[model samples]
Target: MTARTDQAEITALVDRFFLALDTREFTPGWARAYLTDDARMDAPVGAKRGAEAVRTAETALLRFARTQHFASGVVTDAAFGTDDATASWNAYMVHVHHSPAADPLFVVGGRWEATLRRTPEGWRFSAMTVHVVWTRGEPPTAEPG
Candidate 1:
């Protein structure tokens, strides 16, 4: 494929990754959309590798809480190699939870570092690591203080 095509594919894959999370579709089939067979993933809790392991970790996280990962300020850096290519993106994630109330309890903003490889299935994330920058809880009541 051409360099432009590869870059486009990488962008689409990253966009779909967030779409899957928003739709709460963490199934193996869906997870395969963004990850390779031996992908490595690292989060706040821990890290895991392989497709099955990544799926398991994603399932557990989705089950733990209702989350909406809003990725903004996305900037992609792509480098083309002979056969395979690598790309990285910097983004801010606004994590929201829906538990006690139908409101955002916490807004954890962070940066995501992803390493993507070109595959027959298109661009897939071979490794992903998230680094949290800051976390802030929901604002308190504004009645009388």
Candidate 2:
């Protein structure tokens, strides 16, 4: 594939992850579209491995009434020659708590780094990590410990 095509695919994979979470999509094997079978994921709520990462993600998401995520400035260090690559981007997310809570919103901004490997299915994350740069509003009262 051409560089632009590779870049586009990598960027789309990154964007698709946020979209899937915002939509709360848990269709069977959906997580595999984004993560490898042995992926390591570390986020605010917890750390998870492989497809199990979706469980931690969904649990954290259920605490919020709604959630929105935006990813931008994606930069990829393409090593498609080796069928692997690394990418980083900035993210801004807003989580709205269930009504009746005193503080109903939690906002967080962070930088995310991901290692991707190309499998027969497509590009999937082998490892992902996020570094919190800032946050506003209070998080959900019932976050998993």
Q: How many steric overlaps are in each model, in order?
A: 0, 0
lDDT tens digits by residue: candidate 1, 1-145: 6667776777777778877776776554777778888888887656889865666566544542455666654555566455455554555444444345556555667788777776777778888888878877653232211
Clash count (model 1, backbone only): 0
Q: For model 1, name the residue pairs that clash.
A: none
> What's each prediction's TM-score?
0.75, 0.92
lDDT of 2 by residue, 33-96 (tens): 8899899989877789976787887888888888999999998877746778899999999999
User: Lowest summed lDDT over 10 consecutive residues: which window, candidate 1?
Assistant: 136-145
RMSD of each: 6.4, 1.9
Return the clash pairs for model 2, or none: none
- lDDT (CA) for every model shown? 0.66, 0.87
Residue 84 of model 2: what lDDT?
87
Point out the worst 10-residue segment of candidate 2 by lDDT.
136-145
